[model samples]
Target: GAGVSQTPSNKVTEKGKYVELRCDPISGHTALYWYRQSLGQGPEFLIYFQGTGAADDSGLPNDRFFAVRPEGSVSTLKIQRTERGDSAVYLCASSSLGLAGGSQETQYFGPGTRLLVL
Candidate 1:
């Protein structure tokens, strides 16, 4: 894809249900990030992956949230025991050399997946 792309633009699930959000980043990008945006707020960083390993996951709210990048191209964010408080827009972004920390790199963002827990 030309830019980052996420699957299932919208998802609605009952409380305690499990959900998986998929993100396919631009081809060849090495750095991927996941974020969450609530009403009237900016996106909050959740995790960042450099290749298949998670470089930073400190932003994850709790143990219930997890993300993985298996082949370094596609990533998935998994949520266990979803709650109404989890309702938000989940965003995915990718950059070619952002994690290198030499120079700032622009990250391409996807349309995001709106998750609503009832």
Candidate 2:
């Protein structure tokens, strides 16, 4: 089985540009999550999907950011008008059901997509 993987480990762009980060979740996983981590800070939840529906998207910062999981497997995070503040490591994780009750359901993280907005 393939573990979660993200494309473009590092991205550099100027302000006001747009970028799309991709994530490939583990096979047979039903839950996928996106998180952003800035320097010296913990990862912040962005959005999560269960099957083909967005189970929780409250963590999305603004309308400039959007994500989709049309097939309930691969997901993509798109950022519009990229700003310096948006420069951070975009992380993706997937789990069996995203439940914390059991250790077997813990989220496994990808290497991460690092974005640099100048």
The lDDT per prediction is 0.94, 0.93
Instruction: Give per-residue lDDT, candidate 2, residue 68.
Output: 94
Candidate 2 lDDT by residue in tens digits, 74-110: 9999999999999999999998864553236889899
Task: State TM-scores per candidate.
Answer: 0.95, 0.93
lDDT of 1 by residue, 11-83 (tens): 9999999999999999998889999999999999999998899999999999999999989889999999999
Please list all clashing residue pairs in model 2, or write none if there are none: none
Candidate 2, residue 113: the lDDT equals 99
The most accurate candidate by TM-score is: 1
- Top candidate (lDDT): 1
RMSD of 1: 1.5
User: What stretches of model 2 exceed 4 Å from their correct place?
Assistant: 98-104
Candidate 1 lDDT for residue 36: 99
